[model samples]
Target: MPSSGSYAMVLDSTFSTERRACRFSRILIDGGSSINILYRDTMEKLGIKQGQLQPSRTVFHGIVPGLSCSPIGKVKIDVMFGDKNHFHREPIWFEVVDLDSPYHALLGRPALAKFMEVPHYAYLKMKMPGPKGIITIAGDYQKSLTCAAASSQLDESLFIAEEKRLLDRVVAMASKQSDMPTDPKSAETQGSFQAAKETKKIALDQADPKRFAVVGSHLDNR
Candidate 1:
């Protein structure tokens, strides 16, 4: 059992995929999620080939409503957790999604249920039945906050880079048009393009960290 003070912590578990062992900083234990998620980049880092994944049609949503995401595919891999003496190993299904998330993988409800583990949020710990009776894993509170902050910063940077890329594409198109004979409706078309750019800017702003605070706070409070 955990005390009240422990609720401020986030539970993270260290596990290995089929190819390699993952760092603790890259694994998040998320009780709120119904499905386990493995980021595409992480899969690449582990040297897992795309051909290994099975086709999947699952779509996911963020903590914020209306923010939907589609996964690339699904894969089954061996996940090993707990310390050496009391470690547990199992084959788990993970939805592979191409997204920039702080954690490389998220262990969701399905994984927990499979292990028959009990998560104590207030203690920032997890326990499950083992051959020896019980196995426990503790969370790193500071690492959780650091991961959250870094993840947020990375998202902002990606957004800025994407916006710049779009603007560059528009400018290149305009430059190409300048070298050729302009159509009679060129001015109207340019105005419409400018309006579209403004709309993209607004969308970028709406994706700021404030919009994702709900999810961040939930992890922080776990």
Candidate 2:
């Protein structure tokens, strides 16, 4: 194994459906995160829809400070880890988000606690007790980095595309507004008006005279 701090490796692995029919890869094991997250794209890959999600009002932070994220909903699904020989299966609750991310899913503290697993970050491995024996899983560093790099690049490109779309929308709106027929007649008032004996401005704030209210001589102090 490489010496500690020699290299940084993110623990990315795979989780399969209860029956082992489908597998979702590139799942990050984040012990620091308090909640399990399932991205919308993966949720779709799971063949589920937003309408099928159970309602949840819970909000979480730790993304951008001062900003809280509310999940699309919460879902409990049976997931299994490890090979067929020795593995652990359990129902895990995940909060689904519509946002795009580098990984398909994030297995957080909740999953760690449930599985009673210990993860070694430097080695990029996780160990948990199984019914048969101890299951030690390790992720490929090269693949993990490759996936992250590709995902991040795709994310950036998507942002640029969305920015262009927004600019086009704004330009289209401006063109539509310009196309609308307008009468220049509205700017000029039809009749002349006169005010009764005018009075000086009454400064309400002692500090700044600019912040004042006008009181006409015709009106009472009240």
Best by lDDT: 2
Across 122-177, the per-residue lDDT of candidate 2 in tens digits comes to: 77778999998898888767756776686668667766877799999999999999
In terms of lDDT, model 1 sits at 0.72
RMSD of each: 22.1, 9.1
Error of 1 at 158 (Å): 5.5
Residue 50 lDDT in candidate 1: 88
Q: What are the clashing pairs of model 1?
A: none
lDDT, residue 110, candidate 2: 90
TM-score per prediction, in order, is: 0.64, 0.64
| Angstrom error at residue 134, model 2 | 0.8
Please give the distance, in angstroms, between residue 216's alpha carbon in candidate 1 and its true position after superposition: 73
